[model samples]
Target: MTETAIAEHGLIGDLQTSALVGTDGSIDWYCCPRFDSPSVFGALLDEHRGGRFRVCPTGTAYTTRQMYYPDSAVLITRFHAEQGVGEVVDFMPPAGEIATGRHRLVRMLRCVRGRMSFGIEVAPRFDYGRRAHTTDVTESGAVFSAGQLALTLHTVREPEDERLARVRVEDGDMRAGLDLVAGQVRGMILESGADGPPREVRVADFQRLFDETVRYWRSWLARCTYLGRWRQVVARSAITLKLMTYAPTGGLVAAPTMALPEQVGGERNWDYRYTWVRDASFSVYALLALGFSGEAERFGVWLGDRIRERAGGAGGPLNIMYRVDGSTDLKEEILDHWSGYRGSRPVRLGNGAAAQLQLDIYGEALDSVFVGDRAGLEIPYRGWLAIREVLDWLAERWDQPEEGIWETRGGRRPFTYGRLMSWVALDRGIRLAMAHGRPAPLERWTRERDAIYEQVMRQGWNEDRQAFVQHYHTEVLDAALLRMPTVGFVAPRDPRWLSTLDAMDAELVTDSLVYRYNPEASPDGLRGQEGTFSLCTFAYISALARAGRLEHARQVFEKMLTYANHVGLYSEEIALTGEQIGNFPQAFTHLSLIDAALTLDDALDGPTGPATGR
Candidate 1:
């Protein structure tokens, strides 16, 4: 099996889709044209059946290290072998802002020290290995074709070396090996949707593309306004978020890979290559905090379109998630043939949670707009009307029991976090109307917001436990409640919030790694347990900082950073043994990292810093 550790990979993208390049010199996960498309290389989930494109130094006795090229998404994996030192640079050219079906991935290899032998394996099982493909080996490179999908591989060398240029196709796959001296280089370009065989290429062309890609990323990062204590980590998270963003639709995928189990051998694996309203809304705050106003504005426009369309059912104005293109055609299905990551069975595609009635999304939606508006993101008059209509509808049914933020399939409940966010929706709606002088039902919205606040205070709290429970029914603590102070639903120093924080600290915080909720105490209609959620841990850090626990927050923050993989990336969750075990390089984790960094920076800067309010 392609059993690379999840944390040993770095990410690179063209703003439309991305690939996970493991430090072992294998691109184990990738999707073409778009993030949600069927994988062309998915060895991350299955070994023999799922395909992979691997370029590594010959022999297994070499130490490998991976890192991003400074502030850019270009990933470099270096090999330290007894014979010599070599490195592979991997990157995707930015696809710009338009939607297209073409993409290019470039891999450049250089022998930095003495002569070293390298091997190339191109095994692409298209359609997730369901479809057979034909590979044609050529004198220069190779072409792999399967039905409508076609991939052309181009190879070029720095100097004419006939001995290192021969490649062959074996068992429907492409394979080659090269032995290069120091200062020699090899370039391989894999292009998707190739109309014809690639023409002759030169090493100079590859160098030009490499330089241009580096400049593209460095230029984009220049707009970051964060100059605080954790600038490097904050910047890394920002770049990760940018890499996950689909530029054409301004929608950020939750993460790039799917069916990577939260718990090893558990059945909780799910696809995350779609946009969640709740996650993107939080991303709005993080982006604006980093002074990436352009990104926040684009997402505001994308969300406004969702609001105007109103394509959801009883869950208010928007679906909990959608495709990067804003389409609601996600049909959850199982790939019964392909094995899941580490044998976590029943690998799934698409997401059934798209139709879930997560009422908290309304608040997250409006909160994003509100955050963006504060940064000069203006809503058109028609968009404002849609927001008003959504609020009016939510006003009547804000108290209805529905799925919470976790999308638990155990059935709906009047989740405290859902109600908290519903209150946020109305409260922000009222603020926006007053600030912009827009027409809105102020009386009804105010009444409903107050009612939600009062109801949560009364029914959602456990007087015996002296903490706010997950919902009104149980006394169990949830990390989601830690968001109360950040959204202004409750003051940071409020006694009730402090008690809830203390309760969470006692129950949910294990060495600063936070769990969303206890599955044993509160079953989620799923089999087996999950890891400590990375997003929840970062959110916990933010909450801790806001609650004036700066020392504890800093310690937890540093410890959490240690959990990040080799190249400073985090997955959806961390195993009890500290291995990342979910979707690799999740956007929610990075967004919360940015949020936590900003909050902690402000808290540590004392009273002379920017306002800590969201």
Candidate 2:
């Protein structure tokens, strides 16, 4: 509830689940074995009842800085005091492919300079902080016991008298005085003894693990094919997105942590830990364009598998979002007991909107699916069947109104963008069938696509604004509609698209930051204001680049890149004051940035050289 929302950190899960680390070096939020499972450290929602594992500096006059390693998921946080500076390196190795529940979070602490004191606090609140637990420390490590949860901490530093003395004292030097000039690696060990599948950690085992993690990340970075102007910035954002991915299912989440509100003191916070079908499609382009097709291909297979499981004869399609493991059981609830980030009350876990009738996802689905299978990747016949079944379902209901892209609670209007994407889904479906000689109802799909296109062109246009409107009647321009060119709904050079771009520039483009839509002009059923939608801001650059407005696009793209954090990470939205609002390290923002940069590069090189796909 402070000015800065402290204690809100994210965990790097292998896909089964994830953890959230607070600035206090505490794992304040973690749901084991799955992203949407009940919390282990629900302190993010209930500080008193939630479980947390923490390591803190004992000194009072301490300052901290957090950054990820260049082009890697390894996040290193540095703590500096008058005496010395210590760094905690947090990462999950992505090599050798371990099982889901067998995942590990490596927390390495070492003094960077001078001498410093450190303290360790282990509090494990299991089952959303509901179960009682106990703690024990052996010569090997320290273990915490809860109802069905077992957490063990391992390190090279032994339990010395001075180390235990740090518990009561506010400030003092640690037992190990790190020599800054000549670095030393002392062995520390932790063991898990409480229950479950027991595992032991020996200090000697850390060397191989550390080497594997660094090697894994470097190997992954070697796949990047971008040789463009913003290669460094683009690659950093790509690494950030990869870090946010859940490896087990290949289902990349929208973001890492939740309840970080769009407005610091407002109630616009939402949970983003789960995977959305919409995000998968955008990630297809982002991941593929960066020369990382293996992960993208795997994601396509994962999504197809989900469809095979859930595409039951296709009357009404699947839910909008699901657990990282593909479970559709997210039940949203507000945590009234805990005040929210920056006093933004009603801290919530889970998402109710997952069950909302967002008809727009059908379009977002095909956006990624079409591209994923376009360039030599084979989509199964069942996958093709699932795609057709959904489109057929859309043909009958394309005229209906439902929740639009913004997930607005103010009720759905005839959102122009939603209608536009429906057109995309049908169009792409037809194109895919024609390209591969697959069976399809081309007449029906083309009829529906053109029908929707005609209706959108005729009624969605606002004559007064000289641009396409948000819905049928209103003149409010939506930043999402700026993506019309990229989605293939309209050609970039089309006059209508140009006019809409100009209209957005005149209206939504406030210093190159794009608001999702004017909140005042259209109420989204929440109070307070939010920053410019970061996704839309990047989409602006993409739109410009696609239209051959390279000079302007480059300038806008560079400026947007500057808004990224110290380590070149982005979130869903950006506040007016340049703070990253919404979820941290959002996939949507990164994907759009990749899209824009790729387009700019293609523009300069004319597609004959290194870059093959546009």
Candidate 3:
């Protein structure tokens, strides 16, 4: 059996949920109904235990290539062999509440030229493959069942190329694809329906749904605000992030699937399929800044709800992260039954990091709230109170040590970036209070902010190293500090900060990719070596541009773009060997890219690249 890893796949979603489509034309991971839903396609975890749906050209000699439609979310995969070329374009429409059946993964194929052969393997293991599945094939495709979960796939005509690959039975070649003709209708139930979801779909019915999916996506893109040199790349990344968003609650999962290792056969693997308060906050600025306030506003609403719910709790602020639907009951567990991705052991399902105190998220959460408030995204009066309440709570608890931004398993320490962002939380709150004339503890907040600033400068900096260390008294450098200027904490060119920047360049820069911190220097409580952080690399570009090193920064930014996967997607980290590490198409990385690109464009065009209305 051919094996596929999660990070090796490209993600395509319809804004409500997403699926991991492997390079070889198999969907290895996906969740139905929502981003945090149980796996309907779990092949990424254990190719043997977890199931998958694949359509591939016959012949081991066949080479595979893939790309996304320019400026759109449609993904096309081509298989080339001596016999001929076969292609598959996979996608789902982005409209809400369509035909609404069990979620679908529509595949279409086309013979590019001479006769070719292909195969289809529709084996689905529901509920993380803890149960057995029964497959029922019909005229269209097949319906897969295991327990209460049901996932039905729809295909057309006689799919005779068993395993979806075989040359002998073909007159021409396998020619099919998820409809992308702009008017094809496509939608899925995502939940088991009456009679346990229809076993298959009619060809005409599938065609209509496919057309609808295309129209839905096109209409949504019409509202995109990006018009940059990398417009197609940026817009598609934006859409990918949006598609991964769970619509009902406005929560965006960090990534669509779980257990995609950060390193090949390494223990750096962890699940990323949940809403991160920090990531959501950053996403607002990215979307709103790029003229997609619709997305930002949606996220803002979700954040507000979360803030309100958490305010009503004993902690008086919030949990660091939550399930897409705001469930705070994520208990991390290992699926010992299935082998991990790439033989990386301890495949985690729910994230234990949730229980860790990542204080940085409070500031991040408030950052978006502040921005959304300014951009006229309305907050309920009570919701506004909740936001202020969190700020007030932060005013007191900001100095506490917790898990740093990397969500390290290491014992919590005083992360300087966490402190820097705490300052941002207070700064923005103070501004909101003063500007809106809202009742607030401004005097206390200002004093607190000033005191925090004084403390950060005094201890957070290591005079000998001439750089702000990751923690007080430690000589470690952290890439998270690359946001020092972006968050308005300090001038990029301050002599001391400049010295710090130089120190970071010397200590942390590896071929222009920035490491979060030298793991060798600061053990993050994990054993495996990590890759250069993509987010930090982009931040380095932003920092360089801020320091007026535009040529160097622009070069770095351009080169960083080279690291993106073929579909213009990026994971959280880029391995030293150029493999994407961490989660596939991380939102934080893409947003930072947007920030870096915008900053560089401003340096080049004097803030006149393209105006995305506030």
Best by lDDT: 1
Report, for every candidate in turn, its global Cα lDDT versus the true structure.
Answer: 0.88, 0.70, 0.74
What root-mean-square deviation over C-alphas does model 3 reach?
Answer: 4.9
| Alpha-carbon RMSD, candidate 1 | 1.5
TM-score of each: 0.98, 0.89, 0.90
Per-residue lDDT tens digits for candidate 1, residues 1-614, read 44788888899999999999988889999898899999999989998788899998886479988889998999999999998999999999999899888888899988999888889899998888888999987766788889888889887764455534447777799888988889987878899866678644688898999999999999999999999999999999999999999999899999998999988898888999999998888889888888899898888888888888873345567888999999999899999998788788889898998888888889989888888888888888888898998998899888888989988889999899999999999999999999999999899999999999999999989999899999999988889888888888888888998888988988888988999999899988998998899999999998888888898999999999999888899999989898999898899999999988988988899874325346
Off by over 4 Å in 2: 3-29, 42-51, 95-99, 158-204, 312-315, 607-614
CA error at residue 428 for candidate 2, angstroms: 1.2
Cα lDDT of model 3 by residue, 1-614, tens digit: 34574345777776667887888988888777667777767887788878776777654478888887655677788777776666777876663633243355666566676655556666666678776666664434445666666665544432322221121212211222232222232222222434543444444666675567666667777787767666776777777787777776778888776776777677887788888998878889888878788778878877888888777465647887899878888888888987876677778888888888777787787778778888888667787698788888888888888888888888989888888888888888888788777888889999999999999999998888988989984899998888787777877777988998999999999889998898888888988888888888988998888888888898898898888876778887877778886777687788788888877776677653322211
Compared with the true structure, what per-residue lDDT tens digits does model 2 show for residues 28-56?
A: 66666455556666665555555555665
Indicate the TM-score of model 1. Answer: 0.98
Cα-lDDT of candidate 1: 0.88
Q: Which model is ahead, 1 or 3, in terms of lDDT? A: 1
Regions more than 4 Å wrong, model 1: 163-166, 311-315, 608-613
Clashing pairs in 1: none
Worst 10 residues of 3 by lDDT: 164-173
